[model samples]
Target: MTRSATTPRPDAAPETAKTVSTGLIIVVLAFCGTLVSLQQTLVLPLLPDFPNILNTSSENASWLVTITLLTGAVGTPIVSRLADMFGKRLMLVVCLVSVIIGSALGSISDSLMLVIVARGLTGIGTSLVPVGISIMRDHLPSDRVGSGVALMSATLGIGGAVGMPLAGVIYQNFDWQALFLVSGGFAVVMLVLVMLVVPESTVKTKGRFDYTGAVLLSIALTCFLLAVSKAGTWGFMDRKTVSLLVIAALVLCAWVPLQLRQGQPLVDIRTSLRRTVLLTNTASVLIGLAMFANFLTSAQQVQMPAETGYGFGLSVIETGLVMLPSGILMVAMSPVAAWLIRVHGPRIVLIGGAVVMALGFVLRAFLHGSVLEVMVASGITSLGTALAFAAMPTLIMRSVPITETASANGLNTLVRALGTSSASAMVAAIFAAMSMDGMPAVPRWEAYQLVFWIGAAASLIGALIAAFIARPQTIAEALRVPGEVVATERHEVKRPEAENEVVVGGVVTDERDRPIKQAVVTVLQTDGRHVDWGRTDNAGRYTLALPSAGRYLVVVSADGWGPMSGLEDLGDADLDQIRMNRRLLLTGHITDHGDPLPQVMLSLIRHSGEYVATTHADTEGGYEIGLPPPGRYVLTVVDHPTGRTRSRAVQIGSTSATLDLDIVTGIPRPRRQPTEDVPVR
Candidate 1:
């Protein structure tokens, strides 16, 4: 009976069941996400009431919202790293609970300080959306993962859009406390749903927590975000802002060296440095800025009075009602974005999204008056944002290892948040700089035009980056390779077989005669030119097609086996078969007598008169070279960093073949002690 080739082990049935469970979890999480997004806009209508209620200036009241943004910027990356280390489910619960407690507190509080604290608490939950998307990825099936991610990403826009109308209705009819009460109630429901539906997801990572790294990262992010978020209020040139930015720079500079030394790092800094990851993250920042600019500019424009030179004069509720179409459009577009990703691939989808976003901005530059015009601009821009957001996580997921998906995606989200924070500061600056009359001047319709032009420019830059940065081929491309080339004609090359044509075939075995699979057989010519080749089916038996062979060096190698080599004459008649004696042990001690050198890679190169075979030592500095036939072999060991090599000749099989050396001390040690018999493979 013909045996089957190796197939990938099927995923556990329970895992499949859990994947289905992710949909419900995402829905619940999205509901909670809605509450978090609602907080961003819920206070917009109440902006006018803040000064009266708190008896504070407008600028002071603004801190209620600003503080939350600042906290969110600080909290996202920290929470993301913790999720990578601990458990995603646990972090989700913690985030939701923070939102619930904050909402409840803000609903009951009369003081502005209490409300600001409540907002900060809610900010913790707001940062969880990216984390939640990442968690869903761990459980969901590949087929379902994209749509699930897109839907979750859409909540970033949906929650904000829906929150506005909801908040407007509550603020107009009931007290401002009602807004917080509704948010708290929604969060409570989400919390319960999450507990019931969300499965536990924790990536296994080895090593102790990098407390120092986390603290430094947090301090740096806080300082950087604070400076960006408050740039308009604290002038860009202000010493306080400049000082904070410098401190942030210093913290980031110090973080790199510390991370490299740690075995288990909080962030995969080296992996994130890849072109695909780094560039995608950079583009995400620009896209985020553009997305937020849409929110800030359109929200303010829609609510301004018709009598004001550039205002449309719609009530808060009417403004939200008019903007409702854009939210609906975003919801409608998400699945389409998911479909585009599946059809064209993520790189194409990302590039297309950037182009579309830029086009939307260009259109907005011309059309910025009626409620309909603003709605159209919002809808168009949101469609592009949805496409880009959906593609980004997919890109990050594909570029990274399965283990680092959540962490990488989390970092991407953090970068995007930086962009949004910067946009907030930039918008404030634009408004501040464009004053016309005695009163705070409304931006002429032309100001919105200038903002859109800037947005278009940023989007174009993102498009160029995505086109250049992504890998040329993906996993799917690799899978399709067999059919990619078509055979037109066959060409054959013939060469004379040597007098001693050794038909070498043998079962590659371990110390025990167990078959080794995929062991490589190398035939080294006397000249430097040599042909190295492989294949021992499930039963490790390899055959080499000789090329004008004379006395050639033959070598055999597998992972656990000690590498073996021998000199053989491939004479004229194909020498029927040679059963390789799996003996000859090459072993050694790898220790830094003073300090442990954990990252050392030990390689063994055969330097016999005419034979050569190479293999590396395992993590423990122990190495084994395997061979089919035994002969004289010279062993050469090299240290990885210094490139210093040591060599010694040893006879194999003719006498008991056992070789040993101490790598750290660069000293030749005996294969066997004077009394102890050397262990043979």
Candidate 2:
């Protein structure tokens, strides 16, 4: 009904029109991501020499690496959630600022602790990838989102690959301080470009920040990451590691329920648990585990001493060059991945990627005869990583609320980092325990083979997980606005400005005028073409984008309440307070023949095997349970003592309805004598 002054309408004057090219946006964001990721491995080449450089123990120097992982794990979700609440571009700028400040600090300080602190600050930039992906979803035209996201996601691998050689060159020539100074300069440039180029999106969830939940989550992640990352050195059975793990487990046990109770949680646990999001995230972890093995092992394998039969004994610079093609292949495969995602939905892309990765690892396990073979094998895995990485964000965004895209993608990124961390621990353990006998032990070729086999197994497992992701039945279903119901075939309701979007905001309330929190409001054309959908906030407020002004169907549904739908001629006006009166209560009687079946246990299960409700019949055989949104269900009634069960198929409508079940007639039994005391309906 109205437009904000800050967010000019699409038809605004030429001066206010969007002029930035999408290609420039993608490049700016992707390069920003490249710069941020470079921070992760920038100091990696200096790890060995860090003890002397900082006058600290080797273990302390290792924190230069471990600290980044720790802070990245903690910062990503918090920054992502903030991005959704405040603004994506704002957070992007904030992350870059963090990188700039951290880099500057590192350049000026040689103190081991101070540099570790600097690295920790730079780790906050890890949030850049997820937030950048969310921005692309908000800004890019629908057609460009796939390829744009592909290149952005691929940057994670690109930076890691580029960082090694880039850092080696800097370390070889200039002072080590130049590494931080160079990265800081890039961060400064990115910060300036992002402000000048990227548009700050208006899509945001209105809610109070969940500070308590964030604190608890941070503590849990810190403990967990420390335990996992240090377990290789500390021993898995070490008391410190075990204690940290236990603390993390207990804290998470507390955090999940707390999140469930929050109106605006740091993470939407319910949405995250949705079949698509959950499975995609699971596959993400496996993919990360499989993918990182190639990155972690490739250069090391090439640089092994010549005494090792499979070693090339290449210098650091040469090893980095040898591994560089994998990153190049990842960039080159971005368009191909996008094309596959467009032809086949993200589900298929994920599955295909997992399979490719599995085959690549299989090749790695056996094909070490020459540098060319190793490069090709690793490149194949990187190709798959590009595909999988690209598909994951698409799947997640499609499955989550548009308002929570940044937070959702942030969680995906977090799980992926977890996968990478686990891989690091696994590789370290395997190599350490299986090394060749020498004063300075070298990992045997068999150890590398074992790692490759495990990597292959992980990839295949990821493929299996991706295989289980539910596929959308139509192109519209796949591309439906995030947080909206699937579009059903319906007659087009032609109207002016069919291609334009109208911002619709409203509150959902009951007949008593009580705000209904978390209700799903769906806007569709009369013919069932989904326009948009949204979830009410704590105060029952929602916002959506309508495709056009015309007669349309507005559907609202919430837990413990009946669904409501109606038709209205919607135009440049907010779909104000939609009142829902009927509460869906499935009530009926259960009887055995003509007799009441008292105390019978009744369970309503959906056709897809999701449990909806369970209750017990009263002494008079009356039972009532609140129903969920209308769906096909099996109403199963069982007598506890006799263990006799009867299930009747039911179809619930939009409003409440009554259903009387005859238990005896619902189930077939062995024929018995007429005098036999068998319950009858």
Candidate 3:
């Protein structure tokens, strides 16, 4: 693949496209994360009216929130596994598109069932935050990874905090449908931005889609979440709840063994067993429960009738304002979490976050006097939630292989969602059991205090679990400043006298046996001293001039490929048997409205439903992307100016090919041909 200086290289990666700033990338991902989470609470303020609008009972109307929780919990792990197998960006966009379509459907729907279904579709967006975090780890440089992941993780709190107030304002001034309309619009914007900015992950665990595992998991989670959600309404010991729990338990018993035997399980049982992953996930579930407790209780605390003594009697909009500080704190604390993680490791951060959450709950339990106190307490819990969330992903990344990062995080997110679901159920059940003595509809201040205490206990348990999580070497490395000196550094003898600069190196290739040009190959002497290093060229070949070529450990690494190391006994003769495998790459082009689209953004998406790469169209409308060979990809052309975009799924092979994109309009844009103006209706 090497080219002569005089020859024109085929699609030489545009100089402008060489390196994108990590800051911009994280900002896009954080926005997407915020949008995804914002959908969760967008319908919060509109729930009461559902009974009237859809002509359904209050219980039936509550399904608007319930269905979303169920879907997010059940769909997250499934979508995550897909992301791990295919592409993270692709799945993220798919999740967002589902939200857009679902929002669009609900915006016009009069049927209660249809609205519930639309809300369920919106729930899929919850998984995007995890997938985005995984994408950050894959694409962001090492130095930027912590902060990028921190911001992405914090969006969950940020979006949830913002959603309620925003929805409240819209409900007051506009139709309820306006919420869905606005949500759909935001999702569309997020979709375009993600496709433009994020790159698809090259690392993937290739295998057949696990339909059985996916189905079993969906069934198990649905049963479990459904049961938890209905505990307050149906009674904890009701037949329906008992039956659902039984079904979940039985299905899980069978599912665990089934995954253990699968060639490629949906939730990799082996990786999940790792102490770090296990404890981190355990903490995730507990902290998720504690974190969501604040969300469910804060508004009620502010909106209670003044007769209750603890009630501020604020409107929904006013309650939202009171909770605004909580969201602000979450956003503000994310950088602090990132700093702590960089300096002290994610394990410590997880534990610290849990402790902070417990403190927040404890503080609220003891200081429930005024609106200011309530807001301050809520802010503390939000800060803690931000930290815990920010650490969970980092812990998962360190525990699992790069190939499994997305799925693992997805599974972790699923666990957190389950916890959040539990929080909802727990809060409802507690309030239902301990209501105002005279008025059955309201709960006393003491009841709220009890919930706070329970949240504190849950967080304390999370902190305990996080403290037990194993510390991975990667975290250890990250905790130390890059230039810090190690007092225990091993000493090695200088071997300059035994020099034999006869190049003893070979090329690196991907799993498909194609040369992976420009990969870094390093050689260290048997005594553990860094001897030499170099990079592969256009042909994925590297030549290392070793010193005295005794047995040495060689390590090879590329951006998209997994890091590989092996022992090699290099000598003067016959030194050409080194090769490495990496993920595949593909390339393409794009055009706009009937002409070349210069500077337009394009996303190379896999048909399995994940994004692979983001590239810009050249001055002549030419663009290129990288992907694994022998799979399908959807080339997306994003024309921001016209908002007329195109997405067509296409298949490709081992070698690169030409695929030009055309402008498309899902929502009609102004046509080039002039049309007669119509009279206003």
lDDT (Cα, 0-100) at 449 in candidate 2: 93
Name the 10 consecutive residues with the lowest summed lDDT in model 3: 1-10
* Candidate 2 local lDDT, 242-279, one digit each (tens): 99999999999999999987778899898899899999
lDDT of 1 by residue, 363-459 (tens): 7877776778778877788888889988898888656544446677778988988888888888888877775466475665656777888888888
Q: Model 3 over residues 1-681: C-alpha lDDT tens digits?
A: 111112111112233135555677889999988887788888888788889989999899989988998888888888888897787889988999999999999999989989999999998988887788888766665456778888888877778878888998888898889999999999998888888777765445455777999899999999999999988899999999999999999999999998866656788786698798989888888999998898889988889898898888998888877887787778788788887876667888889888988999998987778899888888888888888888898888765655567888988989888898999999988888899888887987788988999999999999998888765342222222112121111221212333222344455666566776656777666555555565555556554444344677777766544456767666534444344443334444454455666788878777887867787887887655654546776777777887767777666654435565556422212112121321111
What C-alpha lDDT values do all the predictions have?
Answer: 0.67, 0.82, 0.75
Evaluate candidate 2 by giving its C-alpha RMSD to the native, one decimal: 7.5
lDDT of candidate model 1 versus the reference = 0.67
Looking at model 2, residue 655 earns an lDDT score of: 57
TM-score of each: 0.69, 0.85, 0.71
User: Model 3 segments beyond 4 Å from truth?
Assistant: 1-19, 472-565, 568-681
Per-model clash counts, in order, read 20, 3, 9
Error of 1 at 663 (Å): 27
